[model samples]
Target: MSGSPYAPHTASETTAMLDAIGVDSEEALFDIPESVRFDGEFGIDAKSEQAARRAVASTLADNDDLTEFLGRGHYDHYVPSVVDHLADRSEFITSYTQYQPEVAQGFLQALFEYQSMLVELTGLEVANCSMYDAATALGEAATLAERLRSISGTRVLVPDLLHEGRRGVLDNYVAGSDLTVETYPTADGNVDREALTEQVDETTAMVYAENPTVRGTIEEGLDTVGDLADEHDALFTLGTDIVALALLEEPASVGADVVVGDGSALGLGSAYGFGLGLFACRGDRELLRQVPGRLVGASEDSDDRRAYTLTLQTREQHIRRERATSNICSNQAWVALRTAMHVASLGPDGLVELANDSVRRARETAGRLDELTGVQAPVHDRHHFREFVARVDQPAEAIAADLEAEGYAVHAVGDHEIQVCVTEANEQALDGFVAAVSEVVR
Candidate 1:
């Protein structure tokens, strides 16, 4: 007890616990290999806070100062400064999980608004406050499909162009369940309807697809994809960012049972790996019960005043472990708050304008790149969103490295193909980026 100040047990209590477990000493409880065990001498000198800040700054400065034109799943849409100002307030940022609705009405209301925003965006009846990210949300959707009494089958079909990270996460999620993930071919960056038709059958559980796919091409004939899934009694899940959801076809209209994507695209501005997973599904009672993450609901208080509270807590932490909808321990509440602030600041019309700009910027940028010799912009024939693939005469990796040398960064997606993403955030640097690309490709 003296040695372990954090441990609650006294010497006799500890001995009793160890005796109950049939271990003579605490050291025997750990099975760690002696060779791999920590020797506990990290040879690092401590530094003052100011000195540490300077050291971190110096290390970060070593990174190349290149304008990134990179986007696959993560995007850097310009976030209004107002979003930061309001969302950073102590009340919003410091609030943890709102278990006590009486004290946490403000944070809960903000989350309710976030859910309402997603509800309208996806045209779905119900929207959870948040999930970990797009990958986890998709994973949750697959499990929901399995849980739904209305749907059946073990096969989860996805587009061939799904982001590898998301695919990997989804694979890890379903590895424990009876579900198996399979890919269907894409035609020119869009779902191949004919090939998809052959793949969908009685065995299909859920059909997952993206609007502007990982290649940045807006999916065509998406309604047909939805229809095909409905034909086989399979659930249709559509993925799209918050901004794109403004201008693209509504997921519900396209027959999507669930809609999941990164809500952070509009608010966070390229928080590279971190994201706010948007999860919404049709409002059917059965579906709502099966939805993952927390849902904030609006209701009347004891005084008959409108109030907000964390409604359906389907996480294993809050409910019976076996009865929980998901084992996800926590959520991106702060990120969701920022996203809601960003969306509210934009309003409906501003959001649509921003989304329109994404389409225009992608097309115009592709057209400019196409004019350069040895570069064919927009390798895909379909309409694009904020990014697109360009075919270059030189090796893609070498061209990307050359572009980096010229103070620009783009993804070398293939042997001769590079994927470029441009939005209002990087629109100011387009001229310099195109000039650099011209020099690199030449």
Candidate 2:
């Protein structure tokens, strides 16, 4: 009976529709053919707004939630106030796909800027409309590699230490398709280069690796992996962390045929969970055409002014099913907007500073925590980013629980090691984290 601007129908209208459907009551309509339906109220005392807010806050307050030191993929960082202010702008928030490109000039320009920023960031030639997240971008990149290889002996070699979620997404993408994935093992948290080299033959379609790996150490060398893939007549694909490009080597420059990642590192918020999946391909004309999703291009309108529009798309559903490379559409406009804004705001110097800050902060925290009685970060190397896996005396979950009880948020990677993220670890926070770990060593 509550009235709201977006609520469509009144109770009477719903009742009339139910009556037209010949169901005497709402509960009767839900009766299953083989099972009984039960009608009962959910047992809960309804509280007033103030009381409910207080209750919810009280429950949440019971837990110790503090500044975190964990970055196994998802990291907490500084998002500027302007992000929320701009995201709330009606045009950006209300936009759909780039279907009406002319009317949605702002949206198209934003997409164009995202592509440009990514291109500049990775040193890649062509970038596309964003994908759902980093994981699916890898899936689509796998498919692109297949198409480049013509998919006959479509075997992709993914290194161990790949995120399980990404692996699942790849499996889902290749399921019932001609392509297959072969996973190589890892040694010392890096890809087994010799095994990876041995695994590749003329039949291999692609080689994929994540930089600084998910566990926070450089692998059997992604650039070397790319070179091998090329030697084996395979496409070199990168499942990179986009933000890391600010500090590390650019995959595209390192011989990656295709580069893609979750650009959530670009100051986007967790509320924007469906992150910006950044993708870029080498400028080989065939390779560019084979890239999935649309690309917004700068063109001149009839009046000879610059205009943006969707120019290239290999999504088979757009042209012909068998001919399409993917089903991901004109995508993630608003999320990409957040990423683009963050990039523009930071520019080159600010971005490098941010990236360096993350690494320094993480190193400081890991070094401090390593001094704790029962905690150690076993893998200390020259090429680690803002995240490192820390081994604690207790199970990772229990350690995280103890930390949380002390009003700290820690990320658990596996059984005994938690991923200590350095994305937003300032000096004070790092010191506090070191102290917290010291206190929680029991």
lDDT of 2: 0.75
Give the runs in model 1 whose Cα sits over 4 Å from its true position: 1-46, 314-316
Off by over 4 Å in 2: 1-4, 7-64, 149-152, 219-221, 314-322, 378-382, 425-427
Q: 1-442, model 1: which lDDT tens digit per residue? A: 1354345788899899999999999999989999998879787666766887999999989987779999898989889999999888998788788888999999998888888889899999888756888898999899999988888788999998889888998999898889999999999999999999999998999999999899999987799999999999999999888989999999999999999988899779987679888899998888877777888888899999999887766544568587788876678888988899999999999999999999999999999999999899999998999999999999999999999988889999999999999988789999999999999898
C-alpha positional error of residue 415 in candidate 1 after TM-score superposition, expressed in Å: 0.7
Residues forming the 10-long window of minimal summed lDDT in candidate 1: 1-10
Residue 79 local lDDT, model 1: 90
Per-residue alpha-carbon lDDT of candidate 2 for residues 1-442, written as tens digits (9 for 90 to 100): 2444355877898789888998867667654864555467697676767888999999979754466665666655677878768877998888777667778788789889888887887888888756888788988888777777343458988877788888999998888567889898877677788888889888888888777678777544567787888788888887666677787778776788787777876657553245777788887777766888777888877888898887764454666576777776557767778888887788898889988876676677678777788888745454567778778888889878888887677778778878777665334566677787888776
TM-score of each model, paired residue for residue: 0.90, 0.84
Alpha-carbon deviation at 73 in model 2, angstroms: 1.3
Top candidate (lDDT): 1
